[model samples]
Target: MKASLETLEQHFATVIAANELSHAYLFVGATNSGKMTLAQWIAQRLFCTNVKDGQPCGECAECRRIEEGNNPDYLVIQRATRTIGVDEIRGLKQELSKSGLEGRQRVFVIQDADKMTPAAANSLLKFLEEPASQVVIILTTTRLARILPTIQSRLQIVTLQSPTLATREQAIQQLGVDSTFSHVLSTTQFSLEDIQGWLEQVDAVQLQQTFWRWLTQILARKDSAFTLVQTQILSTFKEQKLQQLLPDLLLAALSDLFTVKFALNRPLNWTNQQENLQQFANQFSTQQVTALLEIVLGLRSMQEANVSFQNVLEYTTLRLLVVLA
Candidate 1:
């Protein structure tokens, strides 16, 4: 089940009711921040024949078709490869030129739109300038700063923050995570997918062992031998699933180190590995912790750049070792 995007959903429904909706929208936010979910809800609201208050009547034939991916007027543009090229944008323009097959409105959603090539972005800009009467284009991007300036100026920008702690906790329960395990995985913010994923991947006993082993290797090794450990853990699971947990693992590790360094009295979750955490804390200053975060983020960016996961992992491990030393 998807987490609700209640506020943005209401706003979009209001705009549709007012008939003052902009021709284009740029959804700017971090990964898994509800941008795509909001876009779909907006699309359903725009096409729903009977709206009850602010939500679509999921019983309607139109809403059903849209959910089933059978709606003729609704199109979702995702990268067929690493980037959206000029031909894809050109094809969309051709599709838009035709009359709307559906009576109400035609919606096109471009997922990861920041991956649009320069020529494709220019093509999209032309469409935004003289948009079709009943057509709406929605662009979703994690890297809003990288979006074309001309394209940015033409569209209404919606910034979605990470979900609150309470919302994330609710999601953890909704995802059927064991109640006993909630406190450990409950801190993720504004991210439904990550919580859901953790709930799936985690086994309290196994997780404790793996986390301790990983932390131990990082602290004990001098020449970054833990690169092999990183590979082994990541390989034992699905790549996407493992990647989803990286941020949480890193954040937890960092927070523990930070607490010890600052002499804060926060309770330690890593009591079993307290010695290593404290050792790392004493070895690296705040700047080094910040740099390690950048290295982790840099690895993700490289994956976005279409670099192989092996290459990214190798480079990241080497950088992390050097920084730690």
Candidate 2:
């Protein structure tokens, strides 16, 4: 069953209240799915001197210090790049060796724990095996498969679920996205964190519209789809951003097309372009749409493997054109 963030928080609070806290916790979920936020919340409760009814008083000095990153008892380890190295883990180990200077409990949160190098992960494993008393270790990762099995076996794993539709809609609205784009985003499997990241991009709406128009043209077998890739898409966005967002936009559009073809009353990513999507959907067989959707979904893994963004876009355009032909 799916649990909301509040439910998970309350469960953790109860665990803390009972003094049944685990030595280590592994939070696994999609990026921006509140893993880090929950980690911080737990940290606040752990450090708070004014805990009441299984919850931390947010106005407490301990809570404020943790929030401001000024708490010596609370340490956060994160890398700016792809991998967290041995030196970083070693530094954390050294810090963990010490006792909490200010707060009653020491809490260490490692963000993107799957990005740790093998040696770094092993170092962490050693530390977890001999964890300090009164210290709480929280590790978070979007890519759970990449974490070492030995380390995974040592911690309590918390898998966060995507929020319910109502919660997601409220979040999207608060992000200042208009009803149209908000409806499109809230319908997808995207988490609140994912929506927030998209909104941070200045060209997010343009990118979505561009991908929609390109898909429509490709289904119509128009040469402008290929032209748009070369002149507009490739030139408009950086390679990294293009590689990330393009596949997602395409997949969402494909889902909308599938829904439109089947006359499903589901929400769509391109809500304002429903008529256009219906027209596009009518031109393709269900099997054809399904096949194209698979192709687009496969692009995500390719992008993860450092495949060329420009080549992927060109190849996708060519493949879709062939499929339509």
Candidate 3:
């Protein structure tokens, strides 16, 4: 669920009323944290002829056009092929200079602005310094440090955080999922639709079977069999899919170890494998579970370092096996 930023919304409306809104705004936040949604809201409010209470009325012709992505004044600059290059920035400059097609301002929403290449960043600097009077540039990125300082300097920063758990639950309920699925979905900061789509594609039964087999093989010190599992995941699942699932799996493994230590409610995600987890959980102390979580976090960093996924899982499994032994 998108957390409404009432303060920011009011600030935006005041800025608009004063005709002093910044030419560029950099929205910094994690993925799916409502940055994009908030940006669109602000754009709609700025362009809407009949705004109310710092929010867009959502009934006017401008709002409808923007909602449908057909507003001539709205320009979205997303990565065309995983990178925003200088060529794209140059073309945007040409477009920004033109008159607004149908509204007060030409809104340029740059999604994943962190993907901008060095050349593109430099090209964007010129526009930021001398932005067109009737142009609004909204840049959204998860990695603010990657953006050039010059670019950051020309923009006001809008920070968005993950929504609260209660809000997330309400959102899940609105999507018509049961309480059990909602509990699992709460582990992430995604919307209900996003979670449902991911779960629909995940084939969790197959993953659980493979994961259980892998864990058993590790306990038995079957390096060859574990290597095969690693290779299979690398070849079959997309990199992003593995990245998402592995974190949840790591968290579940840590929780299982803890539950075994303290005899708490069975570990959340892997509760179905309680018997197997319990066998080792009783053998390990709570400190060991904490240490295991630390190791998993380090492995997560390795994955983010762009190391091959196969290497990460292989190295991670070996380390865990050694620690358990």
All models: lDDT?
A: 0.72, 0.80, 0.72
The residue-by-residue lDDT of candidate 2 on 188-278, one tens digit each, is: 5455655576567655667666666777788889877888887777765563533565676678788888899888887777678789888
**Better structure of 2 and 3 per lDDT:** 2
Query: TM-score ranking from best to worst?
Result: 2, 3, 1
Q: Which segments of candidate 2 are over 4 A away from where they belong?
A: 29-33, 79-87, 101-104, 114-123, 142-149, 187-205, 239-243, 262-265
- Root-mean-square deviation (CA) per prediction: 4.6, 3.3, 4.3
Which of candidates 1 and 3 is the stronger one according to TM-score? 3
Question: For candidate 1, lDDT tens digit of each residue in 1-325?
Answer: 2234676787777887888899899998766678887887887887888889878887799888888878989899876366899999999999887777856679999998988999999988888999888898999987788799999999999888756655555666677655433544666332556555555665545654565566556555445445555555555434464554555555566666777777788865344456767777787778887777676665556777777656655576677778777
Which 10 consecutive residues of model 1 have the lowest summed lDDT?
A: 181-190
- How much is 276 displaced in model 1, in angstroms? 3.9
| Colliding residue pairs in candidate 2 | none
lDDT per residue as tens, model 3, 165-240 = 6677677756665554455556653445555665566654555556667666664556764576556555545546
Q: How accurate is candidate 1 locally (lDDT)?
A: 0.72
